[model samples]
Target chain A: MNEPTRPLPRANELDTQEFWAATKNKELRYQQCDGCNTVVFYPRRHCTGCTSGNLTWKLSKGFGTVYTFSVVRQSYHPFFRGKVPYAVAWIELEEGPRILSNVIDVDDPLVDVQISMKVELVWEEHEEINIPLFKPVD
Target chain B: MKQRDAAIVGIHEYQSRDVEGKVSALQIKAESAARALEDAGLSWSDVDAIYDAGDGGGMNGLTIAEYFGLKPTVIDTTNVGGSSYEFHAAHAKRDIASGKANAALLTYGSTAHSNARAIGVGGAGGAGRHPADNMDVFSGMTLVANYAMVAHRHMHDYGTTSEQLAEISIATRCHAMRNPDAVRAMEDLEFLDIRETTIDDVTNSRMIADPLHLLECCMISDGGGAVVIASPEVAKNCRKTPVWVLGSGEATKYPQAGGDITASAGAYSGAQAFGEAGITPAEIDIAMIYDSFSITVMVLLEDLGFCKKGEGGAWVEGGRLRFDRPSDGPALNTDGGGLSSNHPGMRGIFLLIEAARQLRGESCSQVPDAKLAVAHGNGGMLGSRHAAGTIIMGRD
Candidate 1:
């Protein structure tokens, strides 16, 4: 089969590259406010919680629980057609952040993916970006 | 609250993929506008004001207005990301408050599926020009990447897992199964069947920029939806029972959603709406929220005070969104949210229409005895860098 096409990596500012780099390792990391010690999700120069310019990057333990999700049985885009029955979810990280990701592993009958199933990291290599995925931990 | 005569006497929506048929954005928008007007039993000449709520894509509203052959003496093009309809309500309120407009019409449409770079006027009355900054979403974390980071942060902090998120998707799909317009809804589908789906499967799923898995983002639909807002008198004169906009509020946070989502968030948006409505969050009977992304809904869980700020992950653990439970808990998006509902170009209008229908007890699939309802919107992401509005609605 021919190589399926992919969307090129969209942005490349100096600050965002590191976060993307971490995704390739299947290890999640975020910038934290050095002042309030609040961990930030999208890497940025300042903390949104405490207005602190002091921020630091920390590696995540790569664990979380599903918060909310949906299974897309209809693909609105050619990019997602074959994956119609795929899962889309918002996993709350152990570090107090909520992000969107894919859920893998296990059998999904009505996908009782549940509201809080434990999950860990998995990675998918795209043409330009390595995407992070999660699977239910046994 | 200021007593006004405006009511949504009409409602309609298109599918999430009509843009695939190669229809121009304006054509789709005009079709929706006409459909809504016809549903309301009105014509274009009755509209004294017009508001165009479009994501920074095509400048189709004015073009459509011209094509429709109506002269709107009072007009605004508040092209906020997704909250355009609600924002249009705000604009109408301001116009009415200032005694500028009598009857206003709000319309939204997009073709994110066809064009990557949306084009519009460089100045006023132009489309694609949002009053808020778009650099972060279009360029920074983009859509998927930024939310991915937030999902990662959420996982690390609350110990939320991907399986939990997957469960949300699964449950929503079940809800979608009942909605005919839902782009994707499957009762028999499971997460594992899709676990192996590659990034390519998601990437091509309709790449609206990057890092956002095809599934992580909202549909880049080529359809349009519309609503007409008139003073209370005109509304009462119309055919349908008016679902009064009792109270409403709009809020903004940081300029960029590419960082921590905690500060300056949805709570502010929810607070304003509840405050304006003079009702506690506990009093809300039903909700039709904007679910542009899964994270948007999760954050609203905390923002609306349904759960503690970070406890949203645990709130839906038991499939509580199902209609089986008839408790004080708010019945939400009973027909399927943006996730399962029709996520055409202008999604907020769908929420507004559904909220009105629920209040009118006219929904095709009604939430039993739904009297008071909330229609919330997140124009962008968690931070509200763009614009987020909440409308507290009640049956008259």
Candidate 2:
């Protein structure tokens, strides 16, 4: 039997701490600029749109559409050693930002995750953190 | 006061297969630099500025200068991934034109295949404590994967077929057959015997990432490329004919949440370059755009105004980029590009060198009456953000 694969280490910066912490609670959160109503993922303090310092964290509906995807058959990372032929997707959230995620719980990702396929958050528990993955909705 | 004109007076390259043993990056860079100086009919004493792509690694310009034994007054180590050399050329052009430096040396060297660390993920000997580390969330979002995502989106939005992308690889291989310096590692054939592949051959090759087969991606090889940009007065006295740096532009799009992966900074940089050069896209005789992946060429073609945004798939179809294509538009990548030639991690310098060669009427697959050419370099990931650098070179 193969050893369970480990998720790559993530460096949670000060601005993105809330994002990682929210994942631990099985909630998907992103930051929005209070001044210009700009939505941001992979959080930062200032509004990228208007350079406003005021930003607020909002919970997503945990749903999104597949903007694009790739099936990985080759990877240089050791964590992906046994996990070849997996689907990595860029999900376009309803909140107007895109997230880099994987579409999970599928028998064949090639046929399942066509462009614009609806998906919802599916959190995977690692040692100390929860990684938010996506699975087909309906 | 008017700014002085700057021109590329010299260019050189070093390409190899690392099956022998370990070779230092510094040695490759130094040799290439010395050859470029020799080509320019100058010595190390003539160089007054150094520009290098020092991404992740700090102060690469200083290190290279110390190795080459030159004391440059100005140094630029701007690292924007693969496109750093184009940025270097852009910066060096301005420095020479503004009289900040009389001569600028731009060099790049990478032992990507020979060195295990160069080919491995997170393998650099550093503390690995950088802000960019947070961007690599997906273990599969490597360079090839990032390009695959772009191709996937392009197909989804524009109905681009996999066969359309394969045409790029086949067309490039056709040109690579004539380039002696190009490294052919895919098959057991000699570089000259590498036959033109069919769309089926490309589609059937092993897929590294979905929508991107092995054929569509660039080959890794150890290589070095260098260029010498000098004031027009200095160039006039050089040994070889000078290729004038007509215009240059660069723009960066951050890969954070708001950026569109489908879109690129090419549109902005291309517009700036054209505006500065006072030339339209139609005026160019040749194009030497970066091709880390086939999708990269198509996307840049659309973004640079060579075709309508969604028309890139059709624009390059039916052998439009081929030298013998019998089209009025510019011929592209007459040197086979990074896809079929050599990609030593940073490929921007090769684009500039090829463009200069075409402008000088020195390319093996030269475009007929080629006088003006465009070289665009792209760096970083697909969806999040990246840098685009465009340089226009001309011969009058």
Candidate 3:
């Protein structure tokens, strides 16, 4: 009965706390502008669109579209070597923020990622944290 | 704009293929600064300003200033990319424009390819703090991958082939065949010279990073080059002919700004540079755009106004860069560029060097009667953070 592994968010302090806290109830959250009702990812204190500092944390539907991706076959760091050849993409969330994410649940050759493919979130647990990756919505 | 007088009167460089020391990279930069001042027929007494024309964030300016034992009127350690040197060239113009300072000297050095086991910068782009007591900064993306992705896009969108890229590399090498200043400077290769190789041949060429072959990227070295700029009045008094800075422009596009540079803001920068020079990109004779990657040269051809965007692949494929053709337009990166020239970290000065030399007819492989030459340097890769500087020189 090994404890299920959870993933970490961005390799930074601010985002890591956000990711782990959301999984306290197994939910995915993004920063939403309290004033303009705009949503942003990798939660920040202000709205990039309107320069509003009033932002609130809210759960997201976990949907996005693949804008571009790279199949990284070479690993520059030990932390990423285990996931050699993983699909890393810059996804444009449906709610309007962009994030660097991993595309999961696809078992094709390296060249299958087409631009603007609909994707949904898929969480994978690594040790103490759950990381949210994306999968084709289809 | 009312222009204050500025000119470059002195020039010096440390031409060591390999020079290593115990102190480290910063120390090398300081030492090179000292050497350049001495060779320029000037001492620390002549410099009124100094700055790192690099992408920034490292201790490059502090290092050079401290080493030379002079407090500059203007201090900057800036980095735009390979365009940094050209930026320096144009920076001299703006500095003169604002009456910021009297004379400025730009210097650069890198031991990335030094034989004495010197290390590269913490990384390429300006990001992440260095480890405790380390002078290097970390770069998130490598310049090669940046260029390759752009090259791939250029190919995907405009039918640019690896073979066409191969041709640019081959032709650049052809130019280097006669240059005495380059390591690969004297290779006798033709467009078809390297076309017969397999993917393995391209793959094994030398993976400086990834997605780019060895031949497709610039060389690294532990060397430094310097240029001196002053008011045109002062320049007329220098020992050598002062290469006038007719016009220049610098621009930056945030990495995440747009999907493609076609509709984005790069053209404004080029137009700005051309405007400052009071000439269009069409009037230029020869161009020396930064050449960290072959794709960059291709992109600059379009961006700098040589041709339209997406047409770089075909423009380069033709005999435009060929030497045998009439030297009418676009024999870009004439000194083999970073692809074939000596790319000592800050290779921008080398572009200035080649441009000045061409204007003086002092280049080893001189462009015949090349008077009004244009040399451009991009400060960062694909302009994620781009700094473009254009130098238009005349013999008269």
User: By TM-score, who's the top model here?
Assistant: 2
Each prediction's total of clashing residue pairs, residues at least 3 apart in sequence or on different chains, is 47, 3, 33
Tens digits of lDDT, candidate 3, B355-375: 777776666666777766777
Which ranking of candidates, highest DockQ first?
2, 3, 1
* Backbone clash tally (model 3): 33
Off by over 4 Å in 1: A1-138, B1-5, B54-62, B114-142, B183-217, B255-260
Chain A TM-score of each candidate structure, as shown = 0.85, 0.89, 0.76
Q: Where is the poorest 10-residue window by lDDT in model 3 chain A? A: A3-12
Q: Report the C-alpha lDDT of model 1 over B1-396, residue by residue, as the tens digit.
A: 344435667666755454554776667667877777777777787888888853434665556568767888776777656776877776676675566766677777666545643111001111122212211221122344345445545655677654444434444445555566653321111222322232234334543322234454554445567777667767767767777676667777653323445433557777877777777767677767776665566667667877786777777666565544447367666666655555654578778887887777876556777777878877655532557778777766
- Ranking according to TM-score, highest score first: 2, 3, 1
DockQ of each: 0.04, 0.47, 0.20
lDDT of 2 by residue, B1-396 (tens): 022378899899775635334666777877889899998998899999998876426666676778789999989999888888888988999888778999999888877766644341221122124434453454446567678888998998889889999888888887887787663443311333366777888899888888899889887777777999999889989998889888888998865444556678998999998888888887887888888888988888888888888788888888888767635587878887887777877789988898888888888888877888899999876455789999888986
Better of 1 and 2 by lDDT: 2
Candidate 1 scores an iRMS of 11.2
